[model samples]
Target: MSSTISRSLAGRKARRRRSRVHSLAIDGNDCMRQDNIVVEIPTSTARAATMTSSSDPIPSLGQHVDFRQRFEEEINTFATSLVHREPKYVPSHQEDALAMARIDSSCETAIDHWMLAQSFGCVKATDLTEGAIELCQLLVGVDGCEETRKVLETLSAHESVSPKNFLRGLCAGAITRWVYLDTKPQLPSVCQYPQSDVLRSVLAATPNIYRRLVDAMTLEYLERHFATTIPALSKELTKRLHTILTNFRGLKSANTLTDLSDHINNFRVWERYMADAFEGALRLRLNHLRSPMKYNYTFPSSGQPFVEDKMISLYSEASRRRPHQVWLCLSPLIESWNESMDSSSHVIISPARVISS
Candidate 1:
């Protein structure tokens, strides 16, 4: 019985030692002790075991959920920071004024080229003058009146005022009247708005922004304005043209009553072209400006001394070298002011094209 009890005790002790060895293997120590002997784990075996434990598969969907949560948290934090930030610096009016000074020369050149092309394609000189004269006669209800004859004589006497130039001058005058005089009252009062001061400062700082705003506003205004004025433009222009032709020199007319008139007619093909060109050019000019700027076209009268700074001669370089007077304005000068009422801030975008005598 004693021998059996001693064997059982020895077996229990061996089992405990084996258990300790198994625990050490599970823990993956590089070296372990068993029965006072150091046992080293094989390098390859230890590496494999380490890789096996680390290579446990994580579900792709779980990883995606965790990534999405982190991303959303970051975005929210960024948005909150922006919301709590202070106001950014607003540009000063003086800065805006400087921006306005930097004109777009390319756009100005393009406008000049476009105007020349359109004018070149206009109605023949004789046809346009004849139609204009006929239209003028019909409107005045007389044929070859003293005023008409005198105006024609005056125009003829000026060697530089050719029939073509006469007609062109009328067209130019008509555009000036239509834009500056006739439509002035109807234009929207941009300055009257509550936020106009803020708007002005902002727009001044960025001229391009003002230009875009002006373009959009002008587009909207033109759509409404043209709808009402297009049908009336031809007659209104004819009247104004006749007035310019007859009254530029302050000539008086004898209102002679004529017999029943057989002259009822619409504008001829070239007349229509003239009106369309006028509208297109006017639209282009109106859309070119920045907001809150006041603009006008300079229409120099006949016999005015030519100022080299304001007027460009259609004459050749050799012809322009001589002293001369402005015989007629082929195209009006375009000038603008930074402030609506401030004449001191005047800027000339384009010089007037003229014929010199």
Candidate 2:
């Protein structure tokens, strides 16, 4: 009888569990279907004991609360921890320190201060140095002061000084002397030989100044000046030519003439003489090399030949005096001159015949 009673109680408990599961499923289904409706889920411990945990089709919306504030607080705490953390150590570079010290110490003088400002502001140190050198050269070339001369002398004396530095000094010295001491209105005097001793000193000190001078030379003004000062130039030209010719006679070698002609041709000062009209002096020098006999015979037969005899050619003797290679290059030019002369003579002779008739 006791066994039967226990069995009845067990059957009752099983029925109750089934009933609770059924009720919970019904509530979950209703909550899922009506999203706007807030289902009151009973928070009783007896009800929780009867319900089994499951992946619900829909969770309770009424019980749901935002975790954004909690997440933001956690993030704030993490950021604050990072902010309060010890800073990393970066060691200073020695080169940077040295460069800053050098810049601070080296910048002196008005020009140096200006250069430093430019270097710090917009320009590089190398660029500033180059620009300063260029400006200094220009200033010296136009008109150098005593201070500039001393600066140049100091720079030139330094074994480590650059070509630009020495050039700046040289240009200043040359220009200063030309403007102040050798103010001859004659172009040849100014261009050819201006205060030779002083000019020589500058050039000797800086052998690289030749190219800069040539590039900067004004050819048009030089040509204009040449036209006005031919008389003064003629005397100088004659003196130099005589010296060259005497040297050529002593050498008795055509190579001497070729070397001299090359020197004269390459000379920037005598560039104006390369024109067809003024090529007489150079041609005459070449002619002497090609036919020394012409000069030798003329000196004894007639008086010392004048510059007017520059074109006087002895075709037979021309080939005899120089080697074939030396005269070969000049053959075409000689032939062209010969043809022109023949045509000119024919025109003259025809006009004379008409008058006679």
Candidate 3:
């Protein structure tokens, strides 16, 4: 298995080397293009309000109703655009719908997504700071866009005051959700996931400034999350790790960086241990065969027309498994479980089987 993975890695490296020349252009991936980006323009509230309502002296009931409906509709449209950051669908007229259709230029869209989320108070300043830092690094890497260089410089200054951008980048890179996939532990491979791939490349290629920024942001993040939780009184007199990590004073900040790195290493070790333990448990626990629902065992279920239905049923557990089949196949069959009482009610859906079998 190690050999196989190594060979795969080698092949990927070879391919990347071949394409390196072609990829020299800044913003090589269309995904990072920032051209034609649209920002959320704050319009005058008075103009919008006037357009929605009417100035009338004791308006008739029909006019009042029409005005009220139009006003509500306009409000809904504005709210929808702000919330979703996309053009809303209009069901009334095809012409109106066609007119609303806007070409989504990629560069413009990426910036818009990042900026629009920040404008409506959906994202915190810290979060924006983190994003801007990442954008700056990205722009520096691409090295082609003069416009992006200016933006990066501006963001760099802002990042010093607020560690938000740095925080955001650290969170996405470290606290990832793609740990396990389909009841199986995922291999630590950038090629397997887009997020991992980008993160690996960025860290490898970024300047020392960004690297130091990452370390600083991570230390601050650890301080915020863990510093206050540890109790002061302790008989062992070993140390309050969180406090030591957070404190920047002579006694406190001295070993803070090393302490944080140790904590992070410990967490990584724990994650690996847990993954291995789970895999072992899955292989050895045959009692899980009878408790399919508990383990989330799933299998293809029969549907209408017999042949057409390929959906896997969560409620119904497969009675038998092939000799070579792993326990992961017998675990919970559904992607996500519904919380309804009907779905939650436990019944002897699958026949009980011997654990030894």
Query: Pick by TM-score: which candidate is best?
Result: 1
- Each candidate's TM vs. the true structure? 0.40, 0.14, 0.17
Candidate 2 C-alpha lDDT tens digits along 1-357: 999999999999978866665566456433322233334344453344333343222445543545555544544443334222222332123332332233222211212222212221221113223324333333223233444444444433444333322222222222222222233333333246443454354455544443223222323234344334544544454333323212112112344666666545434232222121123322232232222121111110011121222222222223344312111010001111132345443211000000000
Provide the global lDDT of candidate 1 against the true structure: 0.49
Which lDDT tens digits does candidate 3 get at residues 96-207? 1221121112112322332222221222223333334333333223333454455444433442212333222221111111111222322234344333443454456544
Query: Residue 185 CA error for candidate 3 (Å)?
Result: 21
lDDT of model 1 at position 332: 66
lDDT of 1 at 303: 59
Clashing pairs in 2: none
lDDT, model 3, position 53:
27
Better of 2 and 3 by lDDT: 2
Whole-model lDDT per candidate: 0.49, 0.30, 0.29
The ten-residue window of minimal lDDT in model 3 covers: 171-180
Ten residues in a row with the worst lDDT in model 2? 348-357
